[model samples]
Target: MVRASAGRIWSVSSNPCQDQIHYAQLNWDEDGQPLSSVFGDVYFSRVNGLEETRHVFLQHNQLAQRWEALPEKVHFVIAETGFGSGLNFLAAWELWLTTAPRSAQLHFVSVEKFPLDKNDLIRALALWPELEFLSQQLIDAYPCIVGEGFHRLSFMDGRIKLTLIINDAARGFSKLLTTTDPLYSQYSAKVDAWFLDGFAPSKNPQMWSEDLFSCIHQLSNAGTSAATFSAAAIVKKGLKFAGFAIEKVTGFGRKREMLKAIMPNNSQDYFYPQPAYKSASTFPSSWSINTNLDIYPDKHALIIGAGLAGCSSARALAERGWKVTLLERNNAIASEASGNPQGVLYAKLSYKEEAQAEFNLTSLQFAQSFYSSHWANIGKKTGVLQLAHCDSEQVLQTQLQEKFAAADELVQFVSCTKASEIAGVPLSFNAIYFPNAGWINPAKLCEQLVSHPLINVVTGIAAFNIQRTEHGWCINNDRELQAPVVIIANARDAQHFEQTQHLPIKSIRGQVTYLPATIASKEIKTVICSEGYIAPASAGIHCTGATFNLKEESKELRVEDHQTNLENLREPLQELLAEWENSDKHSLDGRVAFRCTLPDYLPAVGPVADEPAMLHSFASLRKNARAFIQDTGKYLPGLYLNIGHGSRGLAYTPLCAEILAAHINNEPQPIARDLVNALNPARFLIRDLIKNKR
Candidate 1:
């Protein structure tokens, strides 16, 4: 595992990163309806589930009316306790499509401990033929692997976003409520409507507890409202105790009564903001630092560098109606590390359940689905076989089996014999076979991302010496370009700017050798990854090697590095290498590139802070680690960052782009709040203060 000593702010887990999802066990009723065996309750009302959903959730929440009244480009958020069958979500989406403005977006966040299997969810959704058009779209994009934490899915050309939290209801909300960053906390807690759609409080009492209701209260604002199918006394007391004015409503189907509630204007109750972890005391959770900052996308944004980070950021912002000017120092986009002929789309996951590992797993899953639908022409879906290079075969296999009990379709532990069969070649070690991992051409992806009409690409201009202005910010190179917002995504070169000079970013030189594919080597069908990787031939040439040399930053390729790459591949593909050598083609040809990396191996994303103001405001943190000073640090109003991706740019860039876009547009975040804190560009600055280093 990649280890770092940042105190308890970042926790490491010895167990694998995967959280086996609890799938719903279903039984078909006589009327061709689905029943949950564990909760002993039907998914929806016995009489007309669709109409019942429209009344209890949509009509009670006033979604159609609220959506119609929203301004253009405004985002409406809806949070729910249960996500059974996804009928409520489809209903909300269909209503929003017809009632809401074209520029407006909908964000739906839901938590459910037991998610249905893909086939079961598809079958259950199929029963509602009226929603066939919407159901098919959801089924096509639904996550195949249902691991825990957050599973984010985007649909309708980035107009609809769904964040599915696969965990307990109360615990998940508690975790979300612990966010300390004011810029992110407001978005995290801003829920407009609540759908209390879990099984009846009688059958599923754990989901409707006082704690859960209190969490809902904490997340709700003065005008927030809720609707539920239960009017049980405990449910009523819980909502009332949590500050919602509750009222009995007409029950659906055979129910005697239902409930509708709203946060009263005179209600005066608030929960104490909890810390994410016991030892995280560097900052108070109640600070509303950036809550007042207006992030409307009315002005233009200037983005530096046209690598994956920059291009994807440009696309995300442009989709939100922001005019974007993408600047690249080189003559073309992706002409550096992202300019590699082909980049692998796999994540180097660890058993350690730290923030880095969690980010990798989520981004890996997101990229696989994203590339297939958006960039299919430039990407391939050939699965990857990651060999066990550090530990014993038995130990690796054991960990894989225990961690991914429900994700057999996503990955499997294969013995050497099975590994060879999958690779279509000879192999020497057991491997973790990733069925969904593959490769993509980064240059093509970069080109496609910046093709929007709202984006203007400026090439061959190296921006330096950026300064905060009265209106926004100014970048001066050969010319001056000013924008309300600026994003630095120029890899390690981002440190050239005075604001980011202290960032812990360094460059590592890497070289990849290309081998002409022989008859035997051409038969290899899958990407084989050991200490180094050997991809199957895409253009009659198999790409392999890639020596990671930190001491050298020279662009020149040395023959020794090529030899090292070949030597690293000898053991895993001895037969293939021997056959190619026998053909008298010993000369090695390749390309060299540099990768930007951080000490902790996580990318620096989110808004940049004014260093001087931060140092003055949080000065007390250096003396006493737990100091609760009144001053929240200052941020550079429009300056942001998206850099330090290391070699996982293909996997990390897409979601980081979406996160940055959401932060800029004041939209609901696609991932959890804790994970966002982990990826914050200013995390190291906070670390330094906590350690009394600055």
Candidate 2:
């Protein structure tokens, strides 16, 4: 057992709240079925696991019928207590592909305390050759289940999403709850169905606790259905105590009985014999959902800006069956900050598990998987090395390594020699190696993202004015384009809109120096970052530098900026710098662009709040910052923003896009509720109100 102060590494038993991840310990039966060594139970029925899943969960839940009846552009969400061998999820995915509407999406959220290792998953899933196609996809995109929290994986071209939570059932479900605070009123998670499949109650009784049932109840709504293979009294009682109407059904195979349940449309009909947990205070008005808004009645979205944010948002929505009009002010997509030849997929993580660090880690992991899925076309997985050039950075890296020791596959603290070997170039200092991080051509990625059939791209068209009409918003351009939903992803120009003008987003000029790769410089195989970064040569030219300047706007490349880049790289890549120094200084080439950033370094995402209205609504905060104002935040209905990614846009955009899309569709969020609040667009306004600055 290896333990650290913050979390444990490879410990058989550990606390989920501490971000420890323990893989399932399994023993193979005679039939090659996986038996959980910890729970003393089989993962599935050995006789016929596929058929059992189809009968116990799929058929019992009426998924095929429900999916068939789903309206166009709508989505169905299924939450599960245990992810086991992923048999149930794969079976559901297979059925959904053949039965669900093409325009509808399927979101499957599952919690697994002990996720299988990649090899174990591959072997277990191989038992059924019929599910090979779907199984291969899952295998290819399986996240490195090394820590707690949600690992969101997109499948079937975004039509199916898996939010795999590696934690205890009760704790995982609690995270899905709208608000964990007793002071904030809770909201149901719009979970259409639940699959209560795990080890038996006798073998794993802790998972069938009342806390788990309460969370299930909180995340469900009237008419939400559930199916389980357990008919134990504890299971029945817990479900009933949490207001589910259950019936004992014939079990699968040797089992004599199973359970199927649903929440009735009327609360009076609920079987809540005892008092269920209730919030003492009203839900925060700022985060409330206004039913009258009806922003998503039509699944059409107009995205302003054709950069990484806009293109990513368009693709995410398009994959969910929404038609998007992508408007670009420049001659082409990615012609602004995203036009660089190669953008390093770098993550500046903190030693502590604060919001910024957590967000960066999650986004970095997501971006790595996202780009890996697109491989050679988008970028190379050449990996990245962040040199600890200074003593402070070395100490920070040491702390970070200790904090994430279990996640060795994601990051590693290496000696100077190891770093040099990994980079295929001589290095003078120790570094943090990101094995999955690399470089991406933002332009190529943006083009591919917007190439979806549902996305309509318009170039050289700027949306200067936006007006909210009776039905939706209208963008003033060559021709007025209207959409029920609009996303502002135009970088620094995001604040130019009347609704988002109050946003404290600023433009910082950055220039990337282009150096012709020599034989010596070409030896550098991975991205190396200190004050700036240099990627492995792409097309015979190494992209580096990226000098940061504040309040300066010059599209032309500056020689001084090029010199600044070289000087920054002098210490870290001294050997390579010597080789490149002989080149003509005046002929050096580079590109200049401006990045949009916020004071907090977090991007502005989610719905655009009506500034004045929110200030007035939460006016009591001015007098007492902690005052509980029970009012929903006033927002410009259907307007959202996905900007302020700063220099880390490549690492931030993918997950942020998924977050915005989830908000629009009312799906289970891909991240924690607290992280959602951290990225909330109204955060600045709330801070100002608290400080009495308004």
Position 664, candidate 2: lDDT: 80
lDDT of each: 0.79, 0.84
Model 2 — TM-score against the truth? Answer: 0.93
Off by over 4 Å in 2: 1-21, 181-188, 268-295, 477-479
Pairs of residues at least 3 apart in sequence or in different chains that clash in candidate 1: none
What is the alpha-carbon lDDT of model 2 when measured against the actual structure?
Answer: 0.84
What's the alpha carbon RMSD for model 1? 6.1
Model 1, position 416: C-alpha lDDT score? 89
Clashing residue pairs, candidate 2?
A: 285-631, 285-632, 285-633, 286-633
| Model 1: per-residue Cα lDDT over 1-694, one tens digit each | 2111111111122435423345677777777678887777899988999999999999988888888898886778899888877899999888989998887778898888777777778878988898999999888877755355777787786778887887778766655553543223334446789998899888988778877876786677788889998899888988887788888989888987999999877554344344443345454632224442565455589999999999999998887778899999999889999987767887866555579878988888788767867546776778899887556644765765655645656677888899989999978888888888777879999989999998999999989778877778889933358888999999999889999997988899999888888899888988898878888888888778688978577998787787777778877888788755554334767889989998889998887877777777777778876676655446777888999899899999989998888778665567776777777777777778879888
**lDDT, residue 201, model 2:** 95
Per-residue lDDT tens digits for candidate 2, residues 1-694, read 2111121245332344454456777787767788887787989987798999999999999988988888787889999988977999999999999999987888999998888887788989999999999999998888875456688998868889899988889888887765753322234347889999889999999889888987877777788999999999999998887778899999999989999999877743343332242323434434433322353777899999999999999999999888999999988899999999999998787765578987998899898888876868988889999999988888888877656666677888889999999999989899999998889999999989998899999998899989988878899933459988999999999878998998898899999899999889899999999888999999999999788889998788888888898989999888789866767777998899999999999999888888888888888988988675655667888889999999999999999999999888777889887788889888998888879889
**Candidate number with greatest lDDT:** 2
Clashes of 1: 0
lDDT of 1 at 537: 89
